[model samples]
Target: MWTIYLGLTGLAAANPQVVGLGNYTGALEDPRFLTSLWLTVLYVGGSAIIGQAGLGFTLAGILRTRTGPVRRLVEGVVLLSWIPPSTVVGFLWFALLDRDEGTLNALLHTPGFAWLLDHPLLSIIIFDVWRGTAFSMMLYAAALENVPPAHLETARLADAGVLQQPRDVVFPASAATS
Candidate 1:
């Protein structure tokens, strides 16, 4: 992959003397590198899996039933977040959390939390959730649309509400389709 090539190129450029297992051992011992790995795992699990999965499914279910101006507006907002460049998201978050006079601190009327210095991991995790939830919403919207209306109606006739209907009918329908 181009990714491997790029990584190797950067490695070779950064440390010409670094070779083979030595580089690997050095990297493994690097605290910053290790912390980066942990942060990545946390972000993937917390934001991508948990935040995205739950919110996406919930929004998709709503979009499936609700149609009109409200749905259109919400979809537009989600799509806007989904399409922005990563750098823009990072910049926007930086502004929002900029300790000294960040709007969040002002609005919350609390002392600034030293996020960038002390809790960069949590800061990035929050950023990831905010930026990535829309993607999950979009994916789930498609998934929800594919569920059969007849099945939903049948589940309703069986005296099932939202939770029961989705659990008994929608999830099984999705599983079979997948």
Candidate 2:
């Protein structure tokens, strides 16, 4: 391990080519790179910022409210997704989303669906959601635990409905921190 590290360090020190802001300027000027960067921003915004946050919050809410067999099973599956290494998750999604006979297309009964080629941004967004949502779920679960049960009890006394209680009690409690 040290040999590989020293070798890479030696290679880097040997070729002390400093381009200053040239590469940054060039990348900014390139249409393809700019477009790719913009698309990446969109992908992160759509998936990590929105999709994962939403799903994680929703799943956390479900785990908090619902009970019994199906909830246990779904919680198990979601927690399983969280435990796997991200590389493993990536490879799994890669194999599942393969263009030719991917799991998704196969399930949809569509053949030769070029998912990555035709919808590269959406594919990346979907994968980001898959690999990142669990983190948000775990975060929310912990946050939800800190919420005061007295708030919920008060909401119940006020005849708040299922969703209404969370809206009135939980969200407001967590809003400042969030």
Candidate 3:
């Protein structure tokens, strides 16, 4: 309601007048706004599809075969990464990526390298992947669990390689859940 009123009546102005579609037209005419929109789409699509889903599924597949403390530790760490509030994570990332006195710079021995400024999109995509992978991992883990051991045993008996077993048996069996 507020946005509609502001757009139609130029309510933001002291001497308000009916501007009709003028505000929207002005925004659409701006190249920077269009570029930002494009970047936003790219960021969202890339982070969800390529980064989170890909890495999450891959991790799930790899971890599915393992048992004991290693699996628990990895899952715990990933969950910890996901469970924190975004603001806290953002602050931690900022501190880690800051050009001056940053952990990354100190470790890399490349001081004064502005990671966030130089690679904002990549940084955020990676951050989003780290933040969001837990959901996909948990989902895929559950789905992978439903894949019958008998099918995997049959694949093994047929001389299927390690990767082939998951690619052929596990993936198809879990496709519905995915």
Candidate 4:
């Protein structure tokens, strides 16, 4: 083990020196890099903050008490978003958002509108939200479902509705990190 570790260390030492910070500085000096950074921030804010955490929480809360075949159907559809590959999600979004022959543009009959070129950041954000929000919703569903019965009963005794109980008890409990 010592010999192997020494060999690995020697191999690493033999590699050419790489100035990681210099590369970062060079990239940061480029206008394209700044634009990319802005786009990345926009994507994260729009999809993760606004779409996933916001809308996903609402969907989970609304579906929490839903039962029967309709609930199952909804679950199935939502699970599809969670189960597919990210690349597949991107491709599907591209198909829908394509300029000339895209499904959305065709359905809306909005000719000459290039979704990809005109709204690259927004397009990616929408695709990411569509693909990733299901996981957040499912997580919220599980968290809400696993609330302690005693707390729920206490909330019930206090005349809290299902919605109120989750807000007052379950959400805080599940959101807390050790």
Candidate 5:
């Protein structure tokens, strides 16, 4: 672990010289680095914090009450997102977002609009939301499963609405998993 951590601080594989912290200082001074860092924060906040977590919790709540084909179909779609290899997922996104022959352009009838180049940050954030939603969904589902029946009963006795019960009981209990 120590070796791996130390290795990341040194030179690139192409460069023979080991410049400890030199690359870090250079990156800190670069304007492009600052832009990239801001974009990274946006990507994480938009995709993971808001998009995935919110969608996952909503799916868990909806699917838990559902039965038969509806539940199966929803689960299958969520599972499918996680089943593909990361490389394959990346290629699929690239193909879908391609400017000339991309699916989006074809559907919209607006070809020659380079989405990847024109909106790289947004593209990556959206891609990440799509890719990561399954994990959060599964996590929330498992957490919801472990919620005690007493919580629901108490909420019911109090005449709490459906949404309020989850906020007061289910969500508080499942907060750790999320």
Candidate 6:
């Protein structure tokens, strides 16, 4: 209610006045607003759909066949990225991407590359993917369990390639959950 009232009137400003729709119109007309909106859509869609879902599904599929310490180690590392608080994760990523003394810059031998400023959208999308992939991985891991081992074995015996097994057998079995 307060937000609507503020948006409808000029009461939010130092000098209050009844400027109904002016604020909304101004925001709509601003080029920066449009750019920010577009970037936001792109970032979220790319991260959630392309990056997180795809990578998580792939990881889950690969890990489904494996067992023992290798699987545990990979799952632990992925979950560690998702388990931390957002603030802690943000601070760590900030340190990693910082211009002068960042770990990334040091590793790449690019001393002063401003990653956040130069590639804000890409950075945020990648961060979101890293932060959110564990959920997708776990979800797909459970879903992949629904896929019958017999079906996978049948596909393998039929000479299905690595990608074909997932597309034909695993995907059909897991489509409901997906």
Across 1-178, the per-residue lDDT of candidate 2 in tens digits comes to 7644543342356674554555567768999999999888898789977899988988887787677998788877877877888789878887787888699889988878888889878988887787677789888887887778788888899899988977788888887567
- In model 1, the worst 10-residue window by lDDT is 3-12
Q: Give lDDT tens digits, candidate 6, residues 68-166.
A: 999999999999999989999999999999999899999999999999999988999999999989999999999999988999999999999998998
Question: Which stretches of candidate 2 lie above 4 Å from their native place?
Answer: 1-34, 153-168, 175-178
Q: After superposition, how far is residue 93 of candidate 5 from its true place, in Å?
A: 1.3
Cα lDDT for residue 102, candidate 5:
96
If scored against the real structure, what TM-score would every candidate get? 0.71, 0.69, 0.74, 0.69, 0.75, 0.77
Residue 78's C-alpha lDDT in candidate 2? 76
Off by over 4 Å in 1: 1-41
lDDT of 1 by residue, 10-105 (tens): 356665542446555677899999999987888788877877787778877888778899999988887787687888877877777878877677
Which window of ten consecutive residues has the lowest lDDT sum in model 4? 3-12
| Model 5 bad stretches (over 4 Å) | 1-33, 156-163, 175-178
**Candidate topping lDDT:** 6
Q: Candidate 4 has what TM-score?
A: 0.69
Report lDDT per candidate.
0.77, 0.80, 0.90, 0.79, 0.85, 0.92
Q: Model 5, poorest ten-residue lDDT window?
A: 4-13
Which number leads on TM-score? 6
Model 5 TM-score, 2 decimals: 0.75
lDDT of 5 by residue, 32-127 (tens): 999999988998889989889988888888887788999999999988988999999999998999999899999999899999999988898888
Report the number of backbone clashes for model 3: 0
Ranking by lDDT: 6, 3, 5, 2, 4, 1
Candidate 4 achieves a global lDDT of 0.79
Error of 2 at 22 (Å): 9.8
The window of 10 residues in a row where model 3 has the poorest summed lDDT is: 5-14
lDDT of 1 at 69: 99
